[model samples]
Target chain A: MYVESTGIQVIETIEELQKTLNRNERKDTTVGFVPTMGFLHEGHLSLVSHAKEQNDIVVMSIFVNPAQFGPGEDFESYPRDREKDLRLASEAGVDIVFIPSVEEMYPADGGIRILPGRQADELCGASRPGHFDGVLKVVLKLFNIVDPDRSYFGMKDAQQLAIIETFVRDFNLRTAIVRVPIVREEDGLAKSSRNVNLTAIERSEAPAIYQALQSGVEMFADGANPEAVERQVAEGIIANSSGKIDYVKILAYPELGPVTDDTEEIILACAVKFSSTRLIDNIIMSTKDGTPCSE
Target chain B: MYVESTGIQVIETIEELQKTLNRNERKDTTVGFVPTMGFLHEGHLSLVSHAKEQNDIVVMSIFVNPAQFGPGEDFESYPRDREKDLRLASEAGVDIVFIPSVEEMYPADGGIRILPGRQADELCGASRPGHFDGVLKVVLKLFNIVDPDRSYFGMKDAQQLAIIETFVRDFNLRTAIVRVPIVREEDGLAKSSRNVNLTAIERSEAPAIYQALQSGVEMFADGANPEAVERQVAEGIIANSSGKIDYVKILAYPELGPVTDDTEEIILACAVKFSSTRLIDNIIMSTKDGTPCSE
Candidate 1:
């Protein structure tokens, strides 16, 4: 049922969500879904906005998926603000907000799992083993529950978006994937829920992560090879910020394969650790013209 | 497109099947799906019959999934009488038949896969590792393509049935799984596509496999423990037939857990090998009433 004040229908169980969607289904409504982990930011809201424009109905799911987090990761300390999220979602024109609990999502040991292949062995997946498998598992379950006409994802977590796209294509999922470009702060820090965890000093240094990616993109535009682009991005991050470098990779887009002369599209991506917060950002570009593909 | 002679819509691609099902969707049609490897027998048609009774549309998929077949198994040698199968499918009142080639199903190395947990460790899965993982993967893909309201499976592959049911429940799949009782020969042998591979002597001996299972069911009815029921079934197969016993055991029905007094339902299941041909059979019964649960 919808809360009168918010005018956004809130569904907490899979059954209830399906029932509500089924009612909409009779009218030939096309649904667009945006799945998030509850601590909503501009990046997530951007996805909802895209969904609203393309779909007759927009659904936003707020589930802090435990399966995707590793042992030392901040699953416990992850930021959450339900009231603020609902307010922002309503303003963003989201029609339904599904807030399922942990127990509700994982009622028992699912004895079945979705495992990612080689695309998961580098970048965030390398640092966080079993992360994409968990991500795919939850996303598949969410997709089955929502059965949306289209699902929106941001390119800030570029590798995650690629792997999810791969899953949908390989599995013959009905929902089309809509790629939403990375939404950034005015200074170019990719907006993330984890940005709230940064100290004031760390906050000022975080925009350097995206700045370094832009440098790499510029290097490639100037005819620099992948190795030089990766090195320049790595060096730029080190010189500009106190954050430790995690990785600066320029790989074939979506496939995440080693870039070669034949590669048409590539991604210059990086991750940085600043005391408590770890940030990731990337630029997907056409290798031919060396222009940003999605911006 | 439908072949005029058969009057059954035969689709070979996922896209066309979805498009056809989409047309059915607008009419509030409920679909029932039956997925099988080709060479349809009475057992497969029985599934279609159950599906016909339940839904407005029936989609049967025949894919000899390479993933579910282990090395040295009967995959390459597996029977395929497509012309006969189409005749039977049309005769059985099937609305649509989906026959996808291996390349169509796996266009590329699907880096993503569905892995089964402890439930797959015993019975057929023990000897055939990575088997149910393939089964679940293909089934999930087909379920996605068909988007059926209900799907049908036979209890002859009782362990596979249990695993599929578990997967559907754990993943919150919209498709409801309907368990059709195993169709068997009048002589008590379970009907299977592989039954044709049996030698004359082996074919004669195959009935003993089901007889042994029925004996075990009687033992359980007489208050025998799981061990006694298992041993009795094993000895019966060895005494009555020359076939080598693969496995004979009684376990809790769907979870495949060890049988305990608290277990309400149990399956007395067995497998046998005669030269190259292998056979499996099972009887699911209520512990309290000692009667077959479905049949």
Candidate 2:
């Protein structure tokens, strides 16, 4: 499958991809899928690398999924540079890159969509009406298309990861979900394709988003009340980054519930806007002993 | 996996079943899954036979899914006979019978569920609320758990089959759905596990249900208006059986949309109740030239 030293299969049609994967499947090749919305960054490459390490072949998708975008969102303006993405994917040793068009992916005006259950409404889903649903639909479609042995996602988007975990568990998807640790820049900003959209001034200030989340985690560990931590985090983001805060909440980790004193693991999550650019960051807090708490 | 002459592997947990299947998966064995409720009859056996013919190994599940049953819709009274089912599955050459308890299948109370749009609102779904949602949930779960190359289903539950087909197609499930043609009693009543609930008198009158459907199809084929065909089907059922009609609707096949002039394939479906016994039957009609007309 990887005969080319620098060349990788660039599959555009779903039928061709399925046929190729079916051939590999008959030979009992284990597949790992990494779904991306184009404009590949180090974060995406890390996922691809993880996939290659774990499975026999890695299939990466780079369609700027239209379904996940809402009205007035960056669907049309989302970053795209296919040549750069292809270069990165080849360097990461990807087996295939599936690139489908808007028409090919979403032909029907209104087709099947996955409804995000209880977990979707709190963070990103609260602002973007049907964002999580769209994400679920596309990912589910990709999972079916690739039928991967394992699928990789970053812990950076904790809520999205949690939702996918639930989707796979509840639906009994045998494709095991492998959650990769979040990759961050030296300045501590979580790596994202959207980070490319940040202006020079905004890029420098965006690191404060992660910095604020870290402060909240530290406060919680220092025995501060959940409310106090929430307040400090919100004020820190507004003060340091000069970004409008969307939400700053202290909640139970992985389970995504309200924070109580006895809550073993907690997620300090928030979203902020800087000069019209929206960014999100979070950190998971657990007891110093690092015991497994809420999964 | 079979260790005895009548020794079909009986797995009680999803994890154990997955482990066994994973071993076979690594060996490149083609797995076919047949999901069912207990009290296995010839109809269920037929599905098993179909799976056996197409796959290297067959796995059948017998769990009377409670979620698919509406309140007061015979969930509690649903029949079960483990010993008998085991014997039947063994005789049918089933390789494995997964009999999971409700707790094992649905681990959490407030968990994820599917929201079936469009087609779910008609036919049997019209009479039973959340019926298709429950069916989709369980079937999706079973698909995930088995991760089979193919899943066999009887066309007897036409609406259920149609909905599952749509679910698999839309969700991008790779498990090919093999629709086994409807199995029926010699007297023409479609064989169902529910037939056990019928009293002697009701059982004697049940064949008329299928007979009335035949009359409706004959009338429609003879160029009766859609409304007239509906009337004839309803009247024929009431006259021939002592059962109260739940619904008698002639609709487009597969999509389950309302019947119209341009409808290409037709599904003449009905549900009737005698005392507490309910029975459903349907006939699919299409043009001889294979033009898309009614379904």
Candidate with the greatest TM-score versus the true structure: 1
B1-295 per-residue lDDT for model 2 (tens digits) = 3344587898999998888887434466888999998899998999999898889999999999999999888988888899899999999999999999999998874355677777777778899988988898898888888878899888778888888888777667778998787788999889898998999989998999888888888888888876797788888888877898898887777888887767778888889987876888888888344332221
- Residue A116 error for model 1, in Å? 0.8
What are the per-candidate TM-scores when only chain A is compared?
0.97, 0.93
Q: Which stretches of candidate 1 lie over 4 Å from their true place?
A: B23-25
- Summarize candidate 1's per-residue lDDT along B148-231 as a digit string, tens digits: 889999999999998989888888787999999988899999999999999998888889888888878988899878898898
TM-score of each: 0.97, 0.92
Model 1 backbone overlap count? 0
Q: Per-residue alpha-carbon lDDT of model 2 for A76-115, expressed as tens digits?
A: 8788998888888999999898888877666553244568
For every candidate, give the share of true A-B contacts it also has: 0.70, 0.42
lDDT of residue A167 for candidate 2: 86
Best by lDDT: 1
